[model samples]
Target: MSNILVVDDESSVLSAFQDLLGSGGHTVATARRAEAALELLKADPFDLVVMDICLLGMDGLEALRRIKEQQPTLPVIVMTGHGTMQTAIEATKLGAFDYHLKPFDPAEMLAAIDKALESTRLSRSQVVLDPETTAAVAGDAIIGRSPGMQQVYMAIGRVAATEATVLIRGESGTGKELVARAIHQHSRRAARPLLVVNCVAIPDTLLESELFGYERGAFTGATARKTGKLEHASGGTVFLDEIGDVSLGIQAKVLRVLQERCFERLGGKETVHVDVRVLAATNRDLEEAIAEGTFREDLYHRLNVVTIHVPPLRERREDIPRLVDYFLERYARELNTDKPPVAPDAHRLLQESLWPGNVRQLAHCIQRALIFTRGYPIQAGDLPLPGEVGSDRAAVSGLGDQGLGELVRRYLATYTGDRAHEAFIEQAEKLLISEALRRAGGNQTHAARLLGLSRPTLHAKIQKHKLHADTDRQAR
Candidate 1:
């Protein structure tokens, strides 16, 4: 049930709304005034806000303004007994989900409530969508020197040596399919096509036809006889992505193809045999899916013959430096710019990032930095760690109780985006110098070299940033 906030001055109307929504299985909070509702809103996020147009003290219009200012994407519904068509138009302009007159249809209001909640959930995270373009999936182009990748490298080595069924598991964007392609590239079947089917992407009905092609006149819209992925991948490997999502019916057929080494076309009665290796990848737990009855147990056992789970990028912090260098060079080449390596502080923060979206998110972050930097040496402050909240919430994430000063400096220095990145680098350099000096026992010369700057330059930066005096260190 969705949590909804209802604001109205009339006790009777509020009670009636509570009775209607509570019976429909929704948790409702009734507020007498806009102040009470605003306080409640600040305490916790609500799915939908229902407000009376004529609120006491603070009108609903003002409350709506404050709500939108705080969270532009939040859905609000306006209810008024004094409803005119003009009120509805104004509410729409202010991003209201719907405007309901007093004594409106309880079912229609409830339906609107459902629509808003569903939309809000989907709008928040890009990670909810599967990402597939990480280095592991980039054929042989992705280069990494991290030790964590050694396991994946070894798996690819073992997988390449066989035509047996292989199961690759990892979180979204972990590059499971990359391992699959590496297997194909090393296999004897490298010359043949490596067919791919994203089991989660296509509709279940269409996926069956996608795997085993339908013949002309087999089903409606079967324009002509077409070979299935199994036939196309004969003498090669066929990759089935998101295998955990496959229907039980489809899983049984897949089992038959694996055991018999053949499958009949959708329209034809005759069985056609094909020599093909199967590679399956998924982010979901097939063991749990089988227990839940969504996946077939026998199919899971068959696919688990050679299971390889690729770890997420955050689990491999050692890889960030190598990935940064690789991305800088690759993107530089692609963009036809000088490949200036990232500065040390920038590299430090990048390595420290806990990439929830894994390599795909990292690649996207780097790509944005590269384009945003425009042929300049990427700085540490240029990093983006947009939080899980509103995508536009803040540039540098707070990192849960991180220093306010650090967050502020990081946010401001995020992108010279408009000015040259050199300007932001200069500001960041001063901050680093002061930090290093504070740690270096007030030794200016030592701090200068530690920061890769000349003593004279450091002295000028000290004066510019107005560093605190600690002159007694000279006598030490």
Candidate 2:
């Protein structure tokens, strides 16, 4: 039998939890306050912790942080009566396994306990990380060596392969969906279906039926029985994109599914049980939505068992070259052509500019440049950054509010001779090689990586261009 700790200020709650969990073939330890709970935790090894948010001495969230600091891998389930968005977000961020409202169903509580224990057991079963690759790739979706991206990769590694609910937060175009996919692809449910639901795209009228399905004759246009995305995602994952936009009513239904593991379809009397893990993403501030009463606090806590924040592209400038290389290769393959090298000035300009739309905008910008280039290296003038700044300054300087595409077309139309093209290509390649070598501090391996070239190929190019390797020591 597993040992469980239940911490609550209310004596009655502690007793009730002890009795309920004790009857289910588990040993239950009760603590009336957070301080006592911590002491008990230090004194003994418990399989799981169920603590109240509104504790007597130290609050549950603070206690949670301390507990995690001491034992990060320990699963903590927080309970609360004053369910607020701020409290839920703070608890989840502090590493709570799950959160439940005070009047939660006993069956739901037991199920949550079971799930947490099962997940914890699975996490310890074997080494999840591949020793050779964990320090390198970390995870499949993440593609950078920056400290910020490394943290993201580690988070994915820790939570994937378990049934923990995950919440990914990031600005638009930061590859949140890619992170979700990586988690699913690496999970035990990898063989099962992974369903995606864009919470903001569907109308409120149809969202419920779309997620929970609808029986025939439930509403107008409901001519046949339809299964919802959630049902179809059984034994798998449901990626809820833009989950901050989910309505309060829908949030309540989602909370029920998280709690009871079952839901009744629209106009259906029978309940359907699902073995689904939820991975939610949003660019919106859910804390503000909760304060505005638009988002439910309980639902936030449930989905945010493990939170992964994806830093925007501007925040991790060092990873830009890698991302640029990846996107350029992808688009080049699609276009059936050799990828053009980015000019040194263009690469530097890209690193210095602010990408408001994040990686997605950068990808599009690269594609647009590729389409416009006539077999020459992409120049600084080719990048279509908005706001008349940096790389885009000269392109839009005299255009007087003209669109980026228009300016790009005008710029491309100026390329007249194949001789000029060859000269431009030669000059651009030399400059790019020099810049890459400089960035790599004269390391050929690093320079090749920066330029998306093989070391041998880069060595050949260096010889062809008659460039010195000790360029990093030279003044810019």
Which is the leading candidate under TM-score? 2
Off by over 4 Å in 1: 1-139, 145-147, 387-476
**Candidates' lDDT values, in order?**
0.71, 0.76
Task: Give the Cα error of residue 295 in candidate 2, in Å.
Answer: 0.9
- Model 2 Cα lDDT, one tens digit per residue, 297-337: 88989988999999999899998888787767667766777
- Model 1 / residue 118 / CA error / Å: 35
Error of 1 at 267 (Å): 3.2
Model 1, span 1-476: residue lDDT tens: 77889999999988988998888888999899999999999998787888998988998888887887787556677888886646654664455655677767787677666755754543331211112333332213434555656777777787787777899988887777667777777777665456667876565667887788666689885544444556645666788988876667788889998888888778788687778889999887676666656677888888888988788887778767766766676677777787666888777778776676888888788888888888887886666766332333244344434775665567676654666556756676777877889878787645744665433345556887888635455323
Q: For model 2, give the 10-residue run with minimal summed lDDT.
A: 127-136
- Against the true structure, whose lDDT is highest? 2
Q: Which ten residues in a row have the lowest lDDT in candidate 1?
A: 122-131
